[model samples]
Target: MMKRAEQKGVVENEAPQTSQKSKKQKTCSYGSVFGECDLHSSVDWGNLPHHVILRVFQFLPLVDRARASSVCRKWNEVFHIPDLWRRFEFELSQPATSYLKSTHPDLIQQIIKRHADHLQYVSFKVDSSTESAEAACNILSQLVNCSIKTLGLISTAKPSFMNVSKAHFASALTVVFVNSKSLSSIKIDDTPLDDPSLKVLVANNSDTLKLLKMSSCPHVSPAGILCVADQCHGLKELALNYYILSDELLLALSSEKHVDLEHLRIDVVSENPGQVEFHTIKKQSWDALVKHSPKVNIVMYFFLYEEEFDAFFREETPVTHLYFGRTVSKAMLGRIGMNCPRLIELVVCANGLQPLDDELIRIAERCKNLTAMGLGECEVTCRGFIEFVKMCGGRLTQLSIMEEVLIPDNDYSLDRLHLEVSKHLGRLWFPDMMPTW
Candidate 1:
């Protein structure tokens, strides 16, 4: 009987051992299915191919990418790849107001120290804070050795760059203009960019500059832009305020030595509309531009009162994209329908209570190539909008009409409007509704 008790005790001990082994086997089975296999323990993840690691790092944000470089020596090498630094945008914002986290100063220093020459397409995006603009300028000033190809200074809320001193901003920008002799595109809008800095840009980057957009630059006179047009013969796209757009500039762009311009945008804005007298571009100059570059798109944006519009659309103007920001009169839109035959897209932010039924129909008939339109703070009968849509048919690619713009007529109500519009559009269409909140 003692022997039998001993054997039973032995069986009990063995049973626990068997149960433990079963648990381990179960865990191993799960690991096999879920990629936690025993082999995973022995594999060296840090030994991944350089190209694979580089591609993964490319998708990471600046801060995260920098942290990821410390994972292994291979990743650190991938962090310094030239291709990864070719296109970079420095996002500058204040911590108090901006929801976005600013890029760490330490990382920016590391990039400037190690990869400044690798940068090609660089841009500075700053908020409304002048401090952020100052930070951007500091970085720009440090990129004296950079061979950047494309540079843009974009302000999110307001032109914070305008707050920077002209001397500080110009000196910082001159560093880039001097170093980046091959700059092909530049967009420095709403800044204190003066004539001397512009001349510096033309002197260094004229041979390679292709597109220049410096609208709302109050310090840059017409002569400054004329220098760009005269020297940068390869320029294909230009944008500037109306005050800087002169007959001489247009004629310079139309010269035989200059390349065919693809786009020209002019912003006509006045704080006190009637007080500012806008000079008109002569028909002869416009004709010369069209004769030289037949396919050029002349886009105009007008923000003026009703009386301030007398100088515009008077004759045959080649404006393709037109926008009226403030309240425009019916007579002005009538003039548009009569003169703007090459109109492709139009946006009218506000018009008076007049039902634009006749104007809508007229635009549809006259502007044959009109594909995109947005109307707001305006009145149009449902039937009139439907007729305009029918005339435009499926050719109207983008039709953004506010729901309030439509006044329900006896025939068509707002409830049934989308169905008719969708039928004509060959796709689903709905009027933009104002949010209740």
Candidate 2:
């Protein structure tokens, strides 16, 4: 009788345990069916290591990361970790806008107050309004403990950075230059940035600076840029205007103390398109740069009026990527053959009703490394076009000719031309295609 009583007690204990287990399984299933639990909350995700979870979360956007934090308490902690905030881009749009959703004002304040120190790579892209620039400056001045490694100040509008007063932009930027002593990259284009602030930056972070891009800065003179090149021995990539590109600057960059430069970009922007006097850079200066850094890529972007293009492409240049914004003439295209022998990409925006047969043949014969060609509002004969394609052959990766560029003939009709070109390019060809914007 005592043995029977003991067996009954054991059965009673096992019964309740199994019942509880069943109840828990039912609850999990119900929740899964009702969408109350996501994949991350499921049993499979719970088994993942914490490091893997953190790595997955790191790749998510900031807004998506915020949503992910709600999955669990552990994820919430990982979302707020300082390491996750190292690389960040703050899209500071106004409260209500058409293009992009505005970042909340309260969240911006919170990030500045609590997480400013965690930002290592940060970029502030502002809208057209001056208010956004002011807000950026205000936050910049307040980052007393920031140790930013890379920082970019970008303006969506062309003239918006100038809308901010020079003094204000300079003073606020000085704070960041003074604090972030280990900055490696800085891109501040279109700002009314002057020399004194540059001096402050070079004095503090010149040793660590590597890549600097200020393509459209009008306030900085050649002397200011020279100072940067002299001090920043580790600079690898630089972009500037034709005005600052002098023999002395190239020599400064060629110093034995400096590392081998990798890329140099020149923005040929015109302030007044109607001006008669066109600025030019000597070929000898470019030759010296080539001697020092043979493998370096030289890229040039032109934003000129039709009148301003007369002085360009006078002699041999090391332009790998060339853009012509204005309507180009046959003479200019002809000179391009002689000057840009090492050309890789050519984009001509507009060309008059003249046939570009000779120019096209000249480019194909001379520019052996040319891989892409684009023509807009230009003319090319059918036979000339076939020979040009045969010359470019399989090497031409991109041949964007507007439908109007090819003058159809009985021998080389549009359909026949496309069929022949497609056989060469290994892709569907259409001469009527528009130039990629």
The reply for model 1, stretches above 4 Å from the true place, is: 1-43, 415-420
* CA lDDT, every model vs. true structure: 0.85, 0.77
Off by over 4 Å in 2: 1-53, 67-73, 96-98, 424-428, 434-437
- Using lDDT, give the best candidate's number: 1
Tell me each candidate's TM-score: 0.87, 0.85
Poorest lDDT segment (10 consecutive residues) of candidate 2: 8-17
lDDT of 2 at 399: 85
Q: What does the lDDT read for residue 224 in candidate 2?
A: 91
lDDT of 2 by residue, 189-305 (tens): 888888788899999998899998998788998899999999999999999987777768888887778888898888877767675365666788778777778777888887777
State the displacement of the C-alpha of residue 165, model 2, in Å, after optimal TM-score superposition.
Answer: 1.2
Q: What does candidate 1's lDDT look like per residue over 1-437, in tens digits? A: 12322222122212122243443443344343224745335544456688887776677666555544544445566777788899988888998987655665665776688779999999998999999999999999999789999999999878599999999999999999999899999999999999999999999999999989999899999999999999999999999999999889999999999999999999999988578898877888988999999999999999898888888888878889999899999899988998888899999999979999999899999999899999989999999999999999998999999999999989999989999999999999999999999
How far off is residue 92 in model 2, in Å?
Answer: 1.5
C-alpha lDDT of candidate 2 relative to the true structure? 0.77
